[model samples]
Target chain A: MSVQHVKIVKNVLAGNDQTAERNRARFNAAGVLAVNVIAAPGAGKTSLIVKTMAALGARARVGVIEGDIAGSIDTEKVLAAGACDAVQINTGGNCHLEAGMVQRALDDLDLDRLDIVFVENVGNLVCPTHWALGEQLKLCLPSTAEGHDKPIKYPEIFAVSDVIVLNKIDLSELVDFDRDFFYKAVRALNSHAPIFEISCRTGAGLSAWADWLLNQHPHLDTKTERLHHLSGAPGM
Target chain B: MHELSIASYLLESVEAQAQELGAQRVLAINLVAGERAGIVDDALQFSFDLLTPETLAEGAHINVRRTFMRFHCAPCDCEYSPKVGNFSCPDCGAVGQLTADGTELLIESIEIET
Candidate 1:
């Protein structure tokens, strides 16, 4: 048998990325800010969602997409937390949430009615970084209890995150979490992402976070236009 | 594991290409992965081995080439390979912006016996 060398170069992630761009267009058309919330399991993701909804109360209409491996528990929690709408995605043992999953969840949500949607990714730090869910912002939540070495170990997430929230700061003293070491590690990888230190239990430092989130919500006309521009629509 | 799913995708791609080219057997696959691509090489290889049995790619060799994350400073017009954690530009001290060099997971070529 003779060996035939057929040259075919292709990206493994191209399919997922195409779907992600489609999801992004849908979000842009609806003028909703989609935030991908990523962290390890039990890092106060649910509590932060609850506190964020409470903090943004009466100002903006918020929705949520909860991604878990098997249960709809977090979806129920967010709904109870007064989210305008919530949809749960069970990954069925997958370690991360891909764009295709989020695309399906968006179909269940009333995109036109909501101003912001938080996509709570499955609780794995490494795998989730590889997939883009068409979000305008990527939020990395690492609790102080998880220790300051998270950035050192998971540099990919820190480098790509738009914002980093150090949750469970109330337990910092108890855990001996070194703030200086954490900041140094994070800054080394990502210089622009704003790091927020907050205790979800006490609601401390949430006002600033809420204010920043509110400011990030794009105006309707500008958002649509900008998205159209980015997507290269026929007319400007 | 996500690697299992990724391996499945890779298999699908290989099968499709093999069918299109009308190749009888797949000898090997050339793959490229970047440091921040979120794929563990050993796990990917294990998944590939698990999934390729009794297929055209069964007993095929998957040769993976790993790449590191590289950054560039726009103002300084220089590109630098970051040392694991630090991404700042060395000379100008400007915040290094990530380029498209790394974070790639691609199937470069396939060797088939016809």
Candidate 2:
């Protein structure tokens, strides 16, 4: 029997990537900015989203796709907050939401009418990082109680994130989190992404985080910003 | 968890590639798994062994190799491969940026016959 060797140096997720591109194109056509939020369980990802919405006030309309292993608790919470386009995706048992999963969720919603769609990935640090959900921005939440070692412990997730939020900052003094050490560790993996320290409970420092979130979508520039520049004002 | 799905994608990709080339049988397939990819080698192998029986890669041998994480050291002006949980460079001890070589999940090759 004659056998031949073929060189196929292609990613195993080539098919997945193709599907993600389709999702990206669809999102672009609908003019929706999708951000994928990843973190471990109890990292307060949902609370952050809610506070972000509250911080944005009436200036922005937010859409959420909450991914959980079983319950629709997060969906209920966000919907009660008056988000018009909230969708709950129960992974059933999957630890992450793949690109195809996000694609299906997009089909069910009128993403065109919303300004931002945040896909709260299933609360697994490791699995969720590997799957790209066609998101333009990726936010990783590492709470103060989770310790500073998390960046080094889960380097892959931290390194891949576009923005890192140090949640539970109100408990930062209570918890023994080393701010200097955490900054150094996170910079080692991702030197470019800005790390925001905020507390969802007290609503302190959420304004800066909200500004960053709004700045992510170039199309969402406020009229005040445009007028300020037109009037030759220094800055806000 | 995701490894099982990755394993299925691997099989489907190689089988489709082989069939596109009009290859009748597959002898072996090679995969490169990154240390940071969070995939279990044994689990991926188990999936391959269980699912390939009805396809062109039914009896194909699966080989998975793990690669080290690559870190760019700006001060050192070079790149160093480091193990997970330790980002320090062996020589200069500087960890600047992370390269994607370690998270790669690729189908390196497949052996087949016409």
Highest-scoring model, TM-score: 2
| TM-score, model 1, chain B versus true chain B | 0.86
Model 1 residue A9 CA deviation (Å) reads 2.5
Weakest ten-residue segment in model 1 chain A by summed lDDT: A220-229
Best-matching candidate per DockQ: 2
What are the clashing pairs of model 1? none
lDDT of 1 by residue, B43-89 (tens): 88899889999888887788888888777778889888876445568
What TM-score would every model get versus the actual structure?
A: 0.87, 0.91
The lDDT per prediction is: 0.87, 0.85
Q: Mark the regions of model 2 whose C-alpha exceeds 4 Å error after superposition.
A: A221-236, B92-95
For model 2, how does the per-residue alpha-carbon lDDT over B1-114 read when each residue is reduced to its tens digit?
A: 777678778888988899998888988888888888888888887888888887898888878888977788888878887665667778877666777777888899999987
The iRMS of model 1 comes to: 2.6
